[model samples]
Target: MDKNKEKRPSFVKRFLRQTPHAITMLFGIIVLVSVLTYILPAGSYDRVLLNGRNVVVPNSYKIITSTPIDFLGLFKAIPLGFKSAADIIFVVFAGAIMFAFMEKSKAVENSVGTLLKKMGFGRKHLLIVIFTFIYGFLGVAVGYENNIAMVPIAAVLSLALGGDLILAAGISVGAMTIGFGLSPINPYTVGTGHKIAELAMFSGYGLRSVLCFIALSSMAYYNVRYFKKITKNPEKSLGKGLDEEGISLSKPIQEYSVTANNWLVLSIFLMGLAVIIYGVFNLNWYLIELSAVFLIIALLCGIVSRMGATLMSETVLKAVSLAAPGAFMVGFATTIKVLMEMGNIGDTISYNLALLLQDMSLYTSAISMAVSQSVINFFIPSGSGQALATLPVMLPLGETLGLTRQTTILAFQIGDGISNLVNPTLGGLIAMLAMCRVPLDRWLRFIFPMVLVLLLMSCVALIVAVATGYN
Candidate 1:
């Protein structure tokens, strides 16, 4: 027993070290299973009279399989690459450049810092929670640009509140993800799902939004508990040697004088915000026209702030340079979409899952759909893509099972929202982490449990739907 006890800790340490790679290995197993299942056919059994007794037996012993891809099929699938992959890459590049400019200028940092100082966040926890929630809400309502702004604000507030920077980063991500998760109007995920599924334009999207609101509220409550504990015991909370990192903001805030250089920075940020607002809100202008406006703003600000024409050209060039890495990440994500198409992997996987769900009892089908979609979400990460990819298969299966399409769609939305809490690949996560200066490990410590809680809540919600049936 003593020997076993000593061995257990080492085993656990090894398991923990291997778990991240395990996720990748598990995904590979899933893909292999998907391909085999898609390519192999099981013989159908039929009832027959054998001698004097009725019996069931497989008559046709040959397995049959059909492949979706020939040269023609591959050619046809290529156009989807542009639609699914290229667009995401281009948009991400545009957004990143816009953000880098905002960050370097200190517009995001100063604006957020200035606001938090006025709120007296150190003395009050309620205001901080409310303000954080609002920041998240505005982020979703405004989409990506406004969401990016919320990150710095959330981080600065974390410093003001005397909370751990890492915890603050997690909280920042939680808020942004909440907004992204709940979005009723955004065409990317929920809205697109509703349209593709032929559900109402607004549908019960409002219901999912309400659920996200509840989830965010629960998260905030937990954060308050932790924040209060930290505030009461600063030494324990800050820990030893955590202040050494250059990223740590516990140092005294020095007064910064806004010079010509600073004003030049501020103008670039304000112009970016103006362009984003105009583009996203559909503010009665062409995208090209809006781009022109930003260009003019950049030029005029540069000239007024004593940035010579040559320097202005260099600044634009430099901003584009900084955006390139983000563009690459986005491109890599798009490449996954392309590969899935090439493999017909998405359709095959969805069809198999749908088939499995269809075999379950009716109530089970609804709950199973939620559980299944939630599991799939850990990989896809894009709620709209998951919805689009799976709904075609699941919706037909749901109809055949006599389940309400709306209910199944609701299940998908719930599953999608809950998974976002831990989806590290999300762009909003990087922004939030950068803003709050939190490492990934610290985030998982708090957030992983919270996500599990939300997952349990989702199960409970689905059970209620199963028990009551949809109105």
Candidate 2:
């Protein structure tokens, strides 16, 4: 036992020594993207205001003067990223502290544990399905950033279910991203693409829904398989360092019991979720409103749990402090997007990608559209941001290449969605990983196979979409 404990720590030590911190990785990517702005020719497209949002004018591309990020600008891009992504950054910190305080009353554990029991432990795979699929479509209705608060709860549940942080992230934020990436409602990608393509809103959801289901299934299977592997053998866990505690969150079976207080806290949480959902759909709430809801939930949990002022203050501080690293990384990851915009290379890259799809067979052109979009997704990770930058150019370009506007949008979703699984530039993804305490490298390694599977599915979907004359 002594030897085994010593060996585990050494392995953890080695892992930490070797693993690149997410912030460091993102910082390097920021530098790399900044450099590309210097190397790539700068370009811009004329934009026209439509319904208060600027719509990219198709075929209005022109090469502009190159104004790449200089040395000072490189550092400036980070704070710019922080300002731009402040809403999401706030969500990350808010979600963490809220969950931390809720868990302090042991309320979250008892409540979720009770549900797991009702789920019959035998049906834990169903839990993965519900978390991935249901959560995914919820992402469709409300963007994934709104669902950020659920990740820590899912991570705790995943740990209780004999899975690691990667699995937690996979089912929660990971599945939700599928919805955001492929949302037929055009909450971001589809919606913006439709407006740009001049297609009727909700025009091609049949094919998009099919894509969403298949994509969700692929992710669900991957998450379930991972859960089974880790449960049967704890060594299969991919998290390193202190995160290796896959099953430690669970108490001994006999010791587990939910109290009335647990029920109260759970009710508060559920009601909070319901309110968030209502506000999002009805009031059109975003980051600030969502963060306020979570903060309110945390304070209510503190009140119901009857902690003193001093204890409450300390708890809130601790949760926020614990959340600091992930929050910082969230802003850090957005730096790449900031640097790209600052360097004025976003439209230039889009113009060049449109040029690549100029002459190809219809089916091949559709897939190529997706391929090119996937490449651009690396720099501009936001679905709407990417759509605004590239689709105006690609939409008209698609017309010349005999691809439908709907088909082009389909390719955009495929390319954007799959790459989001691994895009280092996305603040939402970085925030999820940070919340789960899953290192960036570990997640990339864990999700690579699934991403490859999803990519294959995306390619096949794009080809089929074109062949059927989908519009």
Candidate 3:
């Protein structure tokens, strides 16, 4: 090779580098779903508010005249999605602001470095396992969106602990998604699905707990493996070039003291989280309330750090500028659902899929229901929303096929939970990816294998549930 001549990049490398941006991918999805409106029949189910949540009325579905999205209407759905998802977008922006303040204060860096030092470099990877379980528990306890504010902190910790952005997101969002998917107590999916099935609350706790363990363990393993690969060879990292320019593990770890100011900042962050958890479990707070909690915490941190108003304002503006793309991606991802609703096909797709499960064998029907739920999740990313929309029809179909309600709920849990790992419509996933500066295409490529394994494991669990006649 000529010393001064640059080597040509390989074709595979060129193609990988050329992968479409997350926003572009989401836009393409919007177009595809809009087209689906024309090909798939338009239909809907009557909906009523139950316990302050909108739920589809059981046995109320009917085919309606098609209202396919036209070209102009397709473009209109983007803004419509933005309007509907505004709360979440605001949450993302607020989180970025908080993270920026934390970074500026050295609060995140000092705290993470100190924690890793205590763990020792040899045992550092253990942090992944620990945080994975912690986030997983939170996922089961609270909903996924409620944890969006935590991603930036996780990213900081990941980089500090000799890992990359993907690993950071994996331990946080990835673990939460796993927990959300398999949680027996996740009120959003499990609670709502059981209600729609008229089954006792958290009725299948034993099987679900076992599945949760299996899924989390699998995720922890994946995280460790990827961390090791990137640690050994930085070029293997999806964040290779990006990591060098921003946060780098090669940077020396500073000894963070437990100063009074550090304590105040840390205490404020922890107290805010505790209150948020309390509100979620007790007060039933959602996106807007969660965003407020973090916003308050950010302000408190800035005050404790003693940054003047000018500096604080500048910091927030800069953080928001960096996070702007992520905020937009969240809104764009929501357009998939917007388009589906505009075409009146969200329920139609579910209705038709449920109709197909009428004659399947118990095992097959159980697995098929899970698969259908996964597909439905792409359109209705909200756990409670999917439960309300699909479980009504799935429960009746499960009954007709002699499948236990518990088995049906199991299908719903797996279907709704696992797909979040890859669903573009999931705002939290997009926001987390954006925070870490990882493109959605790269994330899909990295996570697709793990998703397949998780899905297979879920199928096996469903089979066992059917065999044991789980109730």
Question: Which lDDT value does model 2 have at 459?
Answer: 83
Model 3 lDDT per residue over 162-257, tens place: 787788778888888888778878887888877777778888799899999999999999999999999899888876555322343334655454
Model 2 misplaced stretches (Cα beyond 4 Å): 1-20, 243-250
For every model shown, what is its TM-score relative to the native structure? 0.67, 0.91, 0.93
By TM-score, the best candidate is 3
Could you tell me how far off, in angstroms, the CA of residue 416 lies in candidate 2 after the best superposition?
1.5
Q: Which residue pairs clash in candidate 1?
A: none
Model 2 agreement with the true structure over 309-370: per-residue lDDT tens digits: 99988887877777787788778778887888778888888888888778778888888889
* Model 2 lowest lDDT segment of ten: 240-249
| Model 1 TM-score (2 dp) | 0.67
Best-fitting candidate, scored by lDDT: 3
Clashing pairs in 3: none
**What number of backbone clashes does candidate 3 have, counting pairs of residues 3 or more apart or in separate chains?**
0
Model 2: how far residue 334 lies from native, Å:
1.5
